[model samples]
Every structure is written in C-alpha cells, then in structure tokens.
Target chain A: MGAIQGFEIRRSSASLRGSATQLRTLPVVAKYIDTSTCIGCKACEVACQEWNDLPVSQTEQVGTYQTMPSLQASYWNLIQFREVDYQGGVAWLMRKDQCMHCADPGCLAACPAPGAIVQYQNGIVDVDPEKCIGCGLCEPGCPFDVPRYSERTNKMAKCTLCVDRVEVGLEPACVKACPTGCLQFGDKDTLLAYGKHRVTALKEGGFAEAAVYDPPGVGGTSVITVLRHGDHPEWYGLPKDPTVPVAVSLWKRILHPLGFIAMGAALFGTLGHFMTVGPKKPKDTSTTSGGEV
Target chain B: MSDASVPASAHPAAPGPSIMRLAVHREDVAVGDEIVRHRLLSRVIHWVVALFFMVALLTGMPIYSPVFGWMATLFGGLSVCRWLHAWSGIAFSVASAVMVLHWLSDMKLVPHDLKFNLVQYMQFSAAEDPEIGKYNPGQKLFFWTIPLVTLMVLLSGIPLWWPTKFGSTLRQVCIIVHDVGFIMWFVAIVGHVYLGTAAEPGTFRSMTRGTVTKAWARLHHPKWFRDVTGDRKE
Candidate 1:
C-alpha cells in the first residue's frame, strides 16, 4: 500500500543496460562478522525472523547443536555450528549464514523478470516479491546457494540486508540482537579495515591461518567475515573462492544479445528472399483451374 | 473421381468416423483435375503442431529476454507464462512427435537429394529438379529438424521445470541448450512458413484445403504430378 522510499538502485534484474542510475550517491554499507567472538547463540536468527515477520519453521536436532542444516525460505539468518578439530582439540566453530549481497550478484544476472532483484547504491541487495516470477533461475545463479524458493508464495526468498531498516538509519535486526559484539555493521571500507585488523590480532595470538574472508571473486562480498581457519573455509561451511557460474555469465552477457540478432537475421532474410525471388507460380495459368472434391 | 455430370448430393460423404471428418474428408478422390497432396488427417495434425508451436514461442519469448516482456501479458503475466511456457512446450513436443511419425516415410533423404544446393535454391540460382518426388531435400531437412530441436528442448526443459532436483551445473547446461534449441527452431519455422505460403503461391492450399491444382503440382513437384495425374507430357 506504501511506496518504497530511499535507496537509489545501482543494478536491476532483466533491465536494459545503463538503466539503473545511482543519483543519490549513498555510502556503501556492510556487515562485519568476527567468527572468533561468536558464542553460537541464535539471537541473530530469532531477530531476523521477528523483524521480517516470518513464521518459525520446525527444526529437529540431527545429532548436533545446530537448529537446522541450512537456512530455509522462511528462516533467513542462521548460525552454522561445526565441531572442528582445532589446535589439537575440538572447538565449536560458528558462522552466520545469509546472503552476502555480492558486488556482482549472480542472482541479478540470471533473473529474467524485470525489477525482481535489485542492488542499492548502499550495497544492499533486495528482492521485490511483487516482481518475482519464481522461475528459480536465481537458485543456480547464486554462488553461495542462498536463495530459497517458497512453495506457498511461489517466490524466491533470501536476506534483503535489511534495506528497509538501513534506509531509516538503523542497523539490521541481526546485528542489533547480537549480544557478543561479533556482529557489527558500518561503512564498507571501515568494516573491511576492522575485519583485517582482527585477522592480524588473531594471527599474533597464535592462529597462523587467521585471515579476512573478503573474496574478490565476486568483487568482494558486502558481508566481510574474519575466520581463524580462513585457509580452510570449508570447515565453517563457506566456499573458499566463489564466483558467478560461467553458464549464467555466458547466457546473460553473450547468448542473450546473440539470440536477438539471430532472430532478426532470420526475419530479414525471409523478407529479402521474398522481394527478390517473388512467389513461385506456374509458367502457364490455362491448366491451373481445377475443382476440389 | 466424379465428373461434372454427377450431382454433388448424389455422392456419400468421405469415409471417416466423426462428424467433423465429414467436413474435412471431402467426396472420394480428386474431382476434375485437382490433385490431393495432403489428406484431412495430415492437415489436422499439421495445424495442431503449428498451434502448439506458436503458443510455446509466444509464451517463451518473454522469458527469453526482457525486450519481449510485453508478450507475457497476452497469456496473463510472467508467472503465468512461466508455467504456461512449459506446458505449451510439452504440447508442442507431443504434436511435433506425431507430425514426425506421420511424415517420416516421405521425409527420408535419398542420395540424389544430397546435391540439392540450399544456397542456390534460396537465391533462385537453381531450378527445382524434375526428379524430386513428394518432398524436396529442403523440405525434408526442415521436417527432420523439427523433431531434433523438439527433443533438445523437451529434454532440457524437464530439468528446468524441476530445477531444485538437479545440480546447478546441469541446470546451467540446460539453459544454454534450451536457448540454442529455441533459436534453431525459430529460424527453421520462419523459412518453413515462407516456403509454405508466400514463396510458393499454391503450396498453402495443400495444408489448408488438402489439395493443390494440377499446375501447382507440375510446377513444384513434376514427378509427383506425373505420378498422380498420369500426365507424361513435358
């Protein structure tokens, strides 16, 4: 019933090239996740559900402390728990799972519906429920496997980076509910620097593999994570190096334009043939007349 | 084969089971000098294939690119087009399969047809061969291409319909395959339509009216005209 105010779009799905103009020039924002200080608390998950007005999904324990194996359509934010063999003993490694809001989002590239997926100038990616046709192209488009298709609504759902809250000068609900200062939100550059700083402190304290996980493969993610076992990202259920699928890139960038050209050529070719050659008719018309049975 | 002396009402309706067949299946054999090129069943099958193909194309173009997004409104919306495209594609595939089987015997490429130069034919540089039978090499090529492209689209579309069941790698491959199949099908259909209608004046009547004039048969298919009409004159 209300118009969406604020947030200038930088990129939009299935739009013409150079159409999404960023007129407002908003500062790029990001969520900084320091996995070292996380206590495996599910506050962020609860906050995300409450803020988004999503119904709770019944999750069963599968011989682990995790609430679920992965994030669901209704459950956007998740705290992934992994008991890893760390420093000669087992330690609980916690990582917040959600959409990374990539600088070069694959979901936006693969989406065929106009205005379904959009990226704001503030570096927040949001899905317009009204515009989404639920073709499920975004599922294979995502490098992180983030987008979830809801059978009830026939639409794809994922973390929107709290675009509504960020527009109103408020941090995301997950960051607000995080008791441990592990979750923080601020300017993208500041968080990148702070995440790197934590990596240095963790390395000095004895973890040699402590590094910032801001992969440049997807033009670096909006959510920057500082992991002690950054060298082995798989331990925390994260891809070490993630990029948009080659098929999505090839289809959107090359095949789409080529298909139009090919169709045009076929049409024009037929017209040209018709004009030059004309219709094939009988040389003599006297014997052409006949009665059908 | 009735002559002008026989009254139209004196003849019984063409042999078929249904009432609609009475309209399609005309009086026994060609009257006067008209040659029966296609029967009522073949014409109906051909139209069914065309109907589903157009439905699939109209519904699919919108999803293929945003440039044709306005076409989605004809069916309902993009969401409706999504499922409609798949269902129509299935219908198209089924109709195409029937068409393929119905025309397979006539569409076989003989060794002599190998010399049928496509470029020369399109440019009107070469004349239609007198030895050509029911179908020319070009027509046979288009006929065979239908089933091949239809199979490609159908196989790829199955995975796309249930995308969550397959891996990302497979779905990505299917996307490219589906688009490639679409382009091939579109281009072929364009040429087929042109040749069937405008390019050849009397050809369209064969599919619609189930007959062509003796002169039309002689001009396009000389050998077939001789076989049907017993006219051996040059």
Candidate 2:
C-alpha cells in the first residue's frame, strides 16, 4: 500500500548492476497493516486482483475459509486465518500477508539473473520477468517464502506493493479498499510514526503483546505489520528471526571472491614455475625410444 | 632409423626416421630406442577423462556465481548451463571411474613411494632412485585422491540438480560442498595439466602419441626403463 511518488530504485540484485541505473536520493515509502483490526474480509485480495487484472484462480476449500492453501502465483495478497486458543475460547487471528520487501533482500542477493529483481528508491521490490530465466533461485533465497514461481510463464511472481498506482500519486488498491481503516500507505517515516502510535493505543486497550513486527534480522522491511502477539511471529507462520540462509551468505560474501583468489594464485604460480624452471630434459640421450626391450 | 638389427647408438640416421616411426605403435622397436610409455587405449582413455573434466569445469563455474556468468553465454544461458553441467559431471564421473580401473594395476604405491620427498622433487634435487615405478608418488597421490573427490562432487551435485527432492538444510550443505569440490578439482586439474605439459618435457606426448623417448623414460622412471629395456647402468 506504499505511495512511491518521486522514487527511483536505489538498491537491486547485484547481478543486474551492469544494467541498472542508480538514483542519488528518494523518500522511502512503506505499507502499515494493523493486524489486530483486520476483519479477514478478503477485500484487499480482490482489489489486488482487480487492479492487476489477474485471472480468477480455481480453488477448493481446504477445511477453512482461507482462500487458497497459501499464496499462489495468481494471488499476491492474502488474509491468513488462524484459530488460536484465547483465555477461554477460540479466537480468529487474521493477518494480511504479502512480500516484506526487505532492506537487504535475500532474493536480490541470491538472484543469478541480471535485472531479475530490483528495489526502488521508494523501497518497492519488483521482479523483471524479461530478465528472469525461471531458475527459481529467488524461491529459496527468500526467508519469508513470498515469491512463487508461475509454471505458465516459468518466472517468479510476488507482491510489488501496487508500484504502478503508487507511481501515479495514488495509494495502493488494497489500502483504498480496506473498509476497517487497518491498512495505511504513506512515506516510510510517517507510517512508522503512525504505527508506533497505533501499537501504544492497542497496548493501552488491554492488548499486552501489541507491537510493531518490523523484524530487524533482515534489516527491517518496507511492509510493517502491527501484531497483537509480535513476540511469537511463528504463531503467524513467520520466521521468528528470519535472516538470509547461511549458505547464501557464505556463497555470495565469502566464497565468491575466495574462489577467484584461489584459482588466480594457482594459475599464476604454475605459470611462474614454467617460466623459471623451464622443462625437464631427458638425462640419457644415447638410446632411442624402442630400446633393448 | 631405429633398425631392429643394429644398436641405436651406431645408427646415425636414427634421428631422420624416428619422427616418422611415431605414426606406428613400436612397443618392441623403440623410435631410436624410445619406449611405448603409454599404450593407445591408455592414451585414449586419459584424453577422454580430460575432455570431460574441462567440460564440467567450464559449465559448472557459471552456475556457481554470477561473477563467471559470461561463461553461460558460451552455452546459451544459465538454464542451459545448469543441465549441461549436470550431464558433463555425470560423464566426467563415469570417465574417471573407467580411468581409475584402467590405471589401477600400475598406479599402486610401493614401499619406495613412502620415501618419496615432494620438497626434494620441487627443488629439482631428488635423484632418480631405481625403486620408482611407472608413476611417482605425486602422480599416484593424485590418482588416488581424484576418484574420492570426483565421487564427492557427483554426490553433492545430485541434490543441487534436484533441490526440492531434498530438505532445504541438506540442499544448502550440498551447495557448499559442491562449490568446495569444484574449487578443489580446479586446483588439482591445473597442476595436472602443468605437470603433464610444461613442467615435464616429453610427458604429454606419451598420452597423445602413446610413446616417450628411451632417454625420457630412463630419466623420469629409471626403474620402469630398466625393466623394459634391461639397461640397469643408469
């Protein structure tokens, strides 16, 4: 639901650095969703589809009103319905789920295709299908499991935060359709301030664990979810402290350069040896190849 | 010419036709007394292994990192590289397996190999001890290490090629192992190429032409040379 006026992509997948153009500065935009006030209406989901002009996906009931099992290639925004045991009875916890668009996006880091993933100066992360090779690297790269691969296109699909509408000085479709006023879109700083105020208000209203769930393990995210139980993100099926996978970090930061160094040293050392020592000569020159044997 | 009727030392014309004799397999009538160091089948299998190894290396490097992404262009793109790398790795493993069995009979390390000093060899100070066989300790060590390393590469590569079949944690570990195995193979192959070609003269031709000069065999593998030619006088 972020408004991304006057923004250019600031950070992007490093593989696409050769083609991507960088901007000097831009205001960051963000989406703030108050989960405590969410009604699980599926309005945002419909709005996302309508605005994006996506096709109706065939779905079957899986023992719950929850639309599809989880996020699908056709559905970017979803309302996760979970029945939790309250003080005495069961209570429904509905959280609107979408891409987090992290400051340090693991998908961007792990992507091998150039320009396949990009982050805007306003903090909207987008995937360029033209550059995508359908390698599915972004699937495992994401800690949140937000990106889904479409078999039809053989490319990754995820939430773009209504980047098109936000680019034209309008709020995202989901924010406009939220009847409960739970979804808010604005400059990142203003939204953070408003989110903080809302969390305090909820805490005062007898919600003990009411807090802003902007996880810092991934350097925070553009989408901030205000949760009633922020301490236990796992209850919402979110990683408690989601960070980039260990192998991805080691592969990109450590092994990438280390491999080059090792190969270079070996090649150069061998070359030096060949130049210095020359070739070993056969000691006995008297006999021919087919000797007494 | 290496006339089988006369001593090579007495034939001054040996040099003139020794080059032509390379066209035939002279296991008995050495090219001016040059020995058939490697047989035709042995040379063919060695090159087959080398070809597969190089193919695997070039194709696998790009998939490992975007830094080497240009290599993908050679095979069309990363998608093609992914499949090509898998097939090449399979071929390389199979060829290496064949090479292991083919060379196993001669590659065995003897008690003399325990005394082989790499430091002395590197400094060009080691004498040609008659105990050395068709292969030195360094070559034998590489021969033994490669099959193990190649198997590791193949096993680790399997998970990466079909990641979803395995757990995420195991897939992550496999990626690291595959990358490490790739680097290890790179180092080993570079050294092998250098030793076979530039470092040791007349060594590469044995694998290509399937023969080496008697003088080369005598200097490099004196014991093998003595066994073949019955020339113990080093």
Candidate 3:
C-alpha cells in the first residue's frame, strides 16, 4: 500500500451517514482503457495479482477464451472476450473488465457494515477485508457484479483501481503492463479529453459505433472503457444504463429511517394507552351468575 | 335445562371441570375466581417461535448490511452469525407452522365477527356482545397473517442463502423481498407484544400460568364465561 497523501475518504458504507466535514485535497484521478486497441493479452490481469499479492485461482473453462469467465476472489482484473459481427465479418471484441469505481457506488450505498466499502478522494472504491462480513450483499448491490467473496477468509475482495501505486505517483500495474499504449492514467478531465480524441480517430477508421462507455447513470465512473460498439454495451457484457437497484435506494433512503420512526410510534402508542386508559381491571362478582352488569 | 330451571338465587356450586378434558392445562376448573385460558403446550410453542424470531433477526441483521455489524458481536462473529441465523430462521418457520395448526380452530372467523365493529373496538366504544368468543377478530387476524408473512420471508430467503443455485436477477429480487418482509414483521411483532403484555394486563398470565381470573373472563368475554360455567337460561 502506498502512503495516502492528504486524501480524504469521500463516502463509506454504513457510516453514521452524515455529510463529510473533511474534504479532498488531491486531484480526481482516473484509469482509461481503450478496448479498441486491446490485444487480449493477459498481462494486465497478471500484473494486478502480482502487484496486490493476491492468490491465483484455478478456474474451469466455461466455453470462453475470456479467462475465468468473470471476476473471482483472487482475480480482480479479467479480459472479457466476445465474438461480435463487425464489417460483415467476425471480430474478437476484447475488454479489460474490472470495477467501474462509480461516483455514486451502489456497493457503498448497499453496504450495511461501516467502512466495509469506501471511496477515496482520488475516486477509487476499495473494500476493507476486516470490515467486510462476507454477507455478499454487495454482490447484487453492484450493477457490474465485481466483488467476489473469499471462502478462505470470509470477506469480499475487489479491485482498488491500483490505489497503492497511483498514490505514490505511479501508474496502476495494469496500465504499466499494457503492451500497446491502450491504457492511460492521470487526471480524469485530461483522460476524458484524450478519450474523445481517440473516439474521433476510431470513427474515421470506419467504426461508426465508437464512443466512450463512461455511464452517467451512476454519476460516471473513474474507470472508463472505450468500446468499439458503445451503443450496444450488452455485447461487452455490460448493462445499457446501469444504476443502483431501486430497492437498494428505497431501503436505504426511505425504509431505514421510516422503520425506526414506525417502531417509535408503536412504543409511544402503547405508552399513551397505558397513561390514558391504564390497565383494564377485571370486575369482581363473586356471587353473581355469568350475566354481567 | 337442569341448571336453567333452578332459581336465580338458588344456583348450586359450579360443576367441576369436565373429566374428558384430560390435558392438565385444558382443565378449565374455576378454582374460586380463576379459570384456565391457554393450555401449557400453546404457551410453550409461542415462546419458542418468539425466541427463534429474535435469534434470526439479530443474526440476519449483520448479513443484511454492515450497518448492523455490531450485532454480529452479540453472537460470535459474522461467520457464526451466518449459519446460526439460517438455522434459526428455519426453526422459526417450522414453529410458526405448528402454531398455526394448533390455533386454526380458534381463529376461524364466524359471521358474528363481521358485525363486530373493529373501528369501535379500537376506539374503546364497542357495545358488549355475548357472541364474542375466546379469541376476537383482531387476535385471529394476527394468528393468520403471521404464518403467511413468515412463509414469504422464508421463500425470498432461499436464493440469498444459496446464490450459485440461482441467477443474479433472482437474487436481486429476493434481496428486496427479504428486506421488505423484515420491516413488516418487525412492525407487526411490536404491536403483538404490546397487546399481549402492557396494553392488556392479565393477558400475559394466560400464556404464563394458562389461566385468567373469573372476573377477567366475565368482563372481556361474557359468552365464553357463560359457556364454561353452563349458566344457561331456561
């Protein structure tokens, strides 16, 4: 882990949920991967595990060249391979799949444990294994399905967007390991500008669907992917307009506070009855028949 | 007609409880002014269900979200909470089923309950009706709905307990249902507890001692008092 320099935490799951008094001093950082230039090399995936000292998981072949099919406990980054019909011929659409690090992270909002999932000032979502209880609530909380539960330690694990190296003024191990100049790391605004330039170049090269895939539904993400067919994110195993589930929002925003209030109302009602009506005393009619007065 | 024909002032000592009712708790013998209410078996089952509900609630809270992580410490930790909560939930479901079966006969709402104005009853302005029996419509409603809600919670919980067995979409739906069910259950139980204890004094003793005062029965349920005492008119 790199030394965190004046980087304040932005949001934490299950905090007292008050406005943060402390503010961030560091620049908002981002990671941009051009899926159009990716060559399906597994170097980034290898770099991620080696840099983090994460375990190597043995995954079964699931009829796909995309290694392991999906993210796993030990594997934070994966290259997803999909065969798409392009230019009247089949083309292999390879993508680097990892956490999106959403500004409004569903995992953070859906988390029940304090400090389990958190976003730092530099725009990286990370999970604290000690705080993670392995409930897997964050599993469905994620629209991309990134977090994986470790059976060994009973906690959730996910990509930190290489927070360690980036904090120390170094690019993420994946960006450093890319064979082509397909991966870039720097200020988010600069990357977005560069991404637009690349998208224009791609469109001129006869890729009509070339566009940026930084979805704004979840308030955008730190990690942006440049898809050749961005209009159809489903082809890349991505939701078209991904947002946090309504139930998660409703539960946290509405039900959580309302439930406590309702319970309080119940208690107050009972006490009011006691104070107003008191206990109903049973009548005493020793010699009387069953007929009451 | 035998006791009916007797003069109003000439009533003999109340007949002893029926010997056919062999269950000790079912013996409705009026020892002076007190009469048996719930049987011992019924009370035991009710508490067992309550115990398991609390256990499941506390353990499930940790797994539901990290906000309730402190609760995990009450048990061992989240590891122990996981299996403990699941087993307790299953136990609660089974116990609720048993309770529903045991009390089904008493919970059957007859035509008289339709005329039993619940609004007036809640307002504490209801006219006394001799047709009212052991359990009122309100109590019957609680008995019926609790089992249904418990079943709903169990059904929604299956996918969450085993994620790989189901798809991601189904798991998302289950999470919503499970959470909504919990909120509803929490509200219902709070009202039920208040009604059975502080709101209605002497009600708790029925489940604890399996009996109530003759005065309490006569005041709350005159028809039931007459039925047990057999003070019929000729």
Candidate with best DockQ: 1
Q: Write the per-residue lDDT of candidate 2 for residues A1-293, one digit (tens) a residue.
A: 22233456565565544322453555788899988899889899999999988789877686777888878778999888888787798767888888998988988887777667888877788887777766666766788878777778667788888888888888989999999999999988898899889889988998778888888989889999888887767767778898988788998789878888889988998898777765666655554342321
Error of 3 at A161 (Å): 1.4
lDDT of 3 by residue, A183-213 (tens): 9999998999999999999999988888898
lDDT of 1 by residue, B1-234 (tens): 221222223344632233133336542233344656777888899999899999899999999998999999999999999999999999989898988998887788889899888888776545668887778888888888888889999999988887667887898999999999999988888888999988877889788777777677777887776665555785
Residue A30, model 1: lDDT of 96
Q: Best-fitting candidate, measured by lDDT?
A: 1
What TM-score would chain A of each candidate receive against the reference chain A? 0.93, 0.90, 0.91
Q: Point out the higher-scoring one by DockQ: 1 or 3.
A: 1
Which pairs clash in model 3? A112-B65, A112-B66, A112-B67, A113-B66, A113-B67
lDDT score for candidate 1 against the true structure? 0.83
DockQ each candidate and list the results.
0.71, 0.45, 0.44
Residue-by-residue lDDT tens digits, candidate 3, B90-146: 999999999899888778988888877655665543545666677777778778888
Q: Any runs in candidate 1 off by more than 4 Å, and if so which?
A: A1-3, A17-21, A85-88, A286-293, B1-23, B26-30
lDDT of 1 at A114: 90
**lDDT by residue for model 2 over B51-153, one digit each (tens)?**
8888788888776776788888888887677678889999999998999998897888778799888757765445677777778898999899889899889
Every model's TM-score: 0.91, 0.86, 0.88
